[model samples]
Target chain A: ELKVEQNPLFLSMQEGKNYTIYCNYSTTSARLYWYRQDPGKSLESLFVLLSNGAVKQEGRLMASLDTKARLSTLHITAAVHDLSATYFCAVDQGRSGSRLTFGEGTQLTVNP
Target chain B: GAGVSQTPSNKVTEKGKYVELRCDPISGHTALYWYRQSLGQGPEFLIYFQGTGAADDSGLPNDRFFAVRPEGSVSTLKIQRTERGDSAVYLCASSLNAANTGELFFGEGSRLTVL
Candidate 1:
């Protein structure tokens, strides 16, 4: 079974501070995804990391993947109040049309 | 027409009742997925359909949960003998293809409350 673990289940950070959320998986996989969910809303895709050393950034959010380490990270640079939400990292277990195994999720609260 | 859509945004049912949730995937999408999200938790995979067949149903909790996509576009999830523990937000997502490179588009989800 593929297991995904995330650190800091709840985070409270002040605006303009930086933090990073870690996602570690127990099995070898080819793709990892980062998603953000606001209260009562569906998930919004943040980044799709497909290869080793792949990194993608948008605004104050950046995501990177290290396949060899079986880990992915979502880094927040200079957080803002609007960035407060729950974030999840999911792994695709290499099955054809496979379902995703998700981490418990990190709930971020950015104080202004 | 822009993204995946789910019907009956919220559903409330009594225990032991049967309920069905519907999902309409993006046009031309061949892969659909269903997941359950408990409060304060990430979405847990339930089933995956490739075309008209269920490619994987391992995440389904038990035989009481069933899903079908007969026409390969729209899908329905059926829960029999609903229990209080079954209350959660059920999410539906779809992708253009079944490859790992494809990104999933999700619907707002249907909140199921088993009272």
Candidate 2:
């Protein structure tokens, strides 16, 4: 069974500060994804890391994948109140159907 | 619909009652998936369908939970003898083609409350 774990389940950071959310998986899959969910809303895609050493950045959010270590990280640079939400990392099993195992998620709260 | 659509945005049922949730995939999507999200938890895969066939239903908790994608466009999830543990948000997702590794798009989800 593939397991995905994320650190700092609950995070409280002040605006303009920086933080990083870590995602570690138990399998050898190379495809990983990051999603963000607002309160009472569905998830939206953030980043798709397709291979080793792949990194993607949008705005203040950057995500990287290290397949060899079975890990991925979502780094927030200069966080803002709008960035506060629940973020999840999902690892694709890389099978025909691409079954995804997701981490528990990190709930971020940005305070001014 | 422009995105994946799930019916009965919220459903409240008594214990042991039957519940059914529906999902409508994108117009051209060939792959659909079902997932369950409990309070303060990530979505867990419940099943996957390729067209009209269920390619993988391994994540289903038990036999009491069943899903069918008749005609391949719309899918229905049936739960029998529901328990309090079944209370959670059921999410539906769809993709253009699983073989091509298309990005999965998720619905807003149907929140089920088994009281």
The DockQ values of the predictions, listed in order, are: 0.78, 0.76
TM-score of chain B of 2: 0.98
Model 1 steric clash pairs = none
Model 1 in CAPRI terms: which quality?
A: medium
Looking at model 1, residue B70 earns an lDDT score of: 99
Q: Please list all clashing residue pairs in model 2, or write none if there are none.
A: none
Sort candidate 2 into its docking category: medium
lDDT of 1 by residue, A1-112 (tens): 7899999899999999999999999887668999999999999989988889999999999999999999999999999999999999999876688478889999999999
Which lDDT tens digits does candidate 2 get at residues B1-115? Answer: 8999999999999999999999999899999999999999999999999999999999999999999999999999999999999999999999888976546899999999999
What DockQ would candidate 2 receive versus the native complex?
A: 0.76
Structural RMSD, model 1 = 1.0
Q: Candidate 2 chain B, which ten residues in sequence have the lowest lDDT sum? A: B95-104
